[model samples]
Target: MYVFIVALLAFVLITPAHAQVHVDIGIHLPGPPQLVVVPEVRAVQYAPAAPANIFFYSGQYWAFANGGWHVSTGYNGPWIVVTPQVVPRPLLFVPVNYYRIPPG
Candidate 1:
């Protein structure tokens, strides 16, 4: 019985398990800033009350950060970005009033 158990253990160690598990977690983004555009700050027309350090508003793409609306020509971009960066990081995306424009 001891010999049988030892042999079984040896066989398990030597042979590769048929039931194998492998996992890959990844989201492939195109390499950094392939096409980089410096955006401009148009107006602080929304909820931030003050413009952001980075912002742009265009027909297709829109990114608001800092104090500007970065408008990209397309979804991926050839962005005409912009900003009015008085402060940093204080401006973040708000879910409740995303499209609500702030009054001066």
Candidate 2:
């Protein structure tokens, strides 16, 4: 009984916990902004006139705001924060000048 309890406690202590956090970035766009294809990276398009650094690639909208990356299905977003790894490679390769609000 004692050995089983120790083994159970060890298992509990060694286990990892995973959690999902939902974040709202508060991005409001009046209408879809015109997207210009990135010259260097053809697959990625950017909104040169947007108030925020916005990109479109692979049928999803990506924005750089509030010191992180956010994504949505439409240009005007109920944005959700995502890790840097999940951002598409083409979008990530966009030139720094293309970003309306460049990251610090």
Candidate 3:
């Protein structure tokens, strides 16, 4: 009975940690992603909104909006914030364009 009680206590203590839900806060782009060409890098960037600096590169869509780096699988998204360290190397070099909203 003591062993069972200890196991039960352990389960109760550990269960909360496992039950935790990780929430990823991010922005959703309006409308479908449009293709944009970055001539300098010879890479195609997808702009979800014209004049808005959100882009899709490789497999993930990227957004330099809301003062942070955001990424998602689809154009319109439940985006998750990404640190500059994890941002793709190619995206780091994108020259400022008309769509890019400068981060203050």
Candidate 4:
């Protein structure tokens, strides 16, 4: 009984943080983008399988998800929304098919 209560309390406490990890910009992408190693970041993926995947560039991480764009300083994000015009052009040009994850 004690263990169950502790587990429940832990879940309740952690749920909000877990939820924040995946932000929804209001648009749902059909799928994630392809992983590419762009030069801007040490090794960044252009697109991700999860619509809200993060890409590292310079000293920040960029996210293209839910029809909007956001940027953060770390992989786990407290993302700030940006307009389409602000998004990197190369990311916009990534082929549509790159979002898919290949079958094993």
Candidate 5:
């Protein structure tokens, strides 16, 4: 009976340490907080659509897979390609559905 009690106590103490749920998500950083569960599935959509075409999904915003940015009136883009002459800026210059009014 004594051995049984000791075994039970040891198990209770050790089991909790291993009971943790290990979830893998992102790459490991060679530093603190080594392992982390990157439940962020959004970042995975980097190369989702065609570089020149785009479509909205899930709820968050999405952009075309185009090697370069584009400008359009709506999701169905292909309009005037935003250039330095169009706006003379980065994200601000674009005019596609991706281009939203600055919140200020």
Candidate 6:
């Protein structure tokens, strides 16, 4: 019985917490920045002129800012923080030089 109770307590304590995290990347573009196709990764286009490391692929705008990845449907965004794993594979493979603000 004690073992069962300990197992139950462990299960309760270890239960994963899900929270919606909104990270304000603070990237406010006056207009859509010029997106140039990345030759190394054909499917992903990067904004070379934008102050932040920004990319466009699969109809979503992605930015690397505030030490994290954020995504939105438009250039000026209500950005949502996302894990690196969730970012598209092709976008992840973009060459270092393409990034306006390369991740350290």
What residue runs in model 5 are displaced by over 4 Å at the alpha carbon?
A: 1-67, 85-104
Please give the CA lDDT of all the candidate structures. Answer: 0.37, 0.85, 0.68, 0.57, 0.33, 0.88
Q: Tens digits of per-residue lDDT for model 3 on 41-95?
A: 5564756355556776787777777677877777766677767898888887877
How good is model 6 by TM-score? 0.78
Model 4 ranges off by over 4 Å: 1-44, 47-51, 100-104
Best candidate according to TM-score: 6
Query: Per-residue lDDT tens digits of candidate 4, residues 2-79?
Result: 999999999888776423344544434444334467544434465444544456555666776655568766554557
lDDT (Cα, 0-100) at 26 in candidate 1? 22
- Superior by TM-score: candidate 1 or candidate 6: 6
Tens-place lDDT digits, model 5, residues 18-103: 33332222212232211211124322222222222232323222233333333333333323333334332332323343322222
- Local error of candidate 1 at residue 35 (angstroms): 24
10 residues in a row with least lDDT, candidate 1: 20-29
For model 3, the superposed segments whose C-alpha errors exceed 4 Å read 1-30, 48-51
| lDDT ranking of the models | 6, 2, 3, 4, 1, 5
How does model 2 fare in lDDT? 0.85
**After aligning candidate 4 to the native by TM-score, how far in Å is the CA of 30 from where it should be?**
23
Q: Local error of candidate 4 at 60, Å? A: 2.1
Positional deviation of residue 9's Cα in model 6 after best superposition, in angstroms? 20
The true-structure Cα RMSD of candidate 2 reads 4.5
Number of clashes recorded per candidate: 23, 0, 0, 8, 3, 0
- Give the winner by TM-score: 2 or 6: 6
Q: Whose lDDT is greatest here?
A: 6
- Candidate number with the higher lDDT (1 or 2): 2
Clashing pairs in 2: none
Which TM-score value belongs to model 2? Answer: 0.76
lDDT score for residue 4 of model 3: 100
- TM-scores, one per candidate: 0.24, 0.76, 0.65, 0.46, 0.21, 0.78
Candidate 1 structure quality by residue, lDDT tens digits, 16-98: 85533321112122432222233222332222322222223332334453334454434334544444452223233323243
